[model samples]
Target: MNSEQRKFEIWRHKMVARQIVARGITDPGVIAAMETVPRHLFVSEALTDSAYGDFPLPIGEAQTISQPYIIAEMTQALELTGDERVLEIGTGSGYQAAVLAEIVFRVYTIERNNILFLRTRKLFDALKYHNIVARYSDGTLGWKEEAPFDAILVTAGGTQIPQPLLDQLAVGGRLVMPVGGLCSQELVRIEKKADKITTDNLGGCRFVKLIGEHGWKE
Candidate 1:
């Protein structure tokens, strides 16, 4: 392998793959996507060393790049087939969007923080991820122009599922999010089929609050 490729492999294995993926992420597609995306490039240069670690790292602006395991787990839970249009509610560092770009047909990511939105757009450009469209907006509102997404992933915590997001999900689509109060949250997977919506609690997780009209009051 070439120098850069070799370096990425080492980083993935030692910092992300072995500890994160092997522990609970069973989906091959999720594993492959995470392995190929350069997580280090998504964070600040000062925290590059911890880029591939299993835990979340600060990315400034009171945000963090979600942990690799959580990313993989959420992606796997969606049961994506690589042909669906995915909507990401939080584009903290654009790392999740980059990973989704590797597997989905198109990725529409929304970031509430303007600084993170600009920084992530630059990262997407630098990495040549043309499939991802980044926007600075309230994530809880969902992207109305890009409604009827095949899959929606929310990266923050809320007391309840945002109704706008549920409305935006196409029939037979899936939405994964962490739902509950600030200190207590459970990862939930909502599936919409025809006119009915089914909900399943995956597990508990802690995440920053999702602030918006249909989300937590801020």
Candidate 2:
């Protein structure tokens, strides 16, 4: 088998199947995508050994690669069908975007941190994941030019769902985000249907602050 395949097998056993999936991820597609992606590539060289570990790790610039379970859970929550255009609000490490790319038609990810934007762009290019479009910008504005997204995912914490992002959601589109201050937050799922919107609280989570216009105060 090729090295990539071997790495995938190791990831399946060591990360997804043995750790995340077994721990109740329940989404087979998410598990498969997590298994196949080489997560180590997204992390810094110093953290390579713990790449497959079931925990978050710092990825520089006061950001971190979300824990593997969180990634799987959030991706699965979107209920993707491999045909929707997904907008990811934070592209830290590009790990989440990579996972979404494997399951969606295309991904447009925005990172407010310039360093992270450049680094993630290079990583996506090197991995030949052409479907992901990475940009350095304020994620809370929801990339208005590319509105009507099939799905929108905010990876950072904010005080509330940004109105612009809500406006950008396509009719029947789903938006998943963490809302609250730095010390506490709730993971919320919002579904838009025409002019009506329904929201559900998924659970609690802690994420870096999303700083930008329409996001947290500077």
lDDT scores of the candidates, listed in order: 0.89, 0.89
Off by over 4 Å in 2: 1-8
lDDT of 1: 0.89
Number of the predicted model whose TM-score against the real structure is largest: 1
Model 1, span 1-218: residue lDDT tens: 99876876789866555766557777777788887898988888898777887799999998889888888888889999999999999999898888899999999999988999999999899999999999989999999998999999999999999889999999999999999888979999999999689999999999999989888877
Candidate 1 residue-wise lDDT at 160: 92
Residues 13-43 of candidate 2 have per-residue lDDT tens digits of 6888777777788777787789778898899
Worst 10 residues of 1 by lDDT: 13-22
- The C-alpha TM-scores of every prediction are 0.95, 0.94
| Candidate 1 Cα deviation (angstroms), residue 31 | 1.0
How far out, in Å, is residue 165 in model 2?
0.6
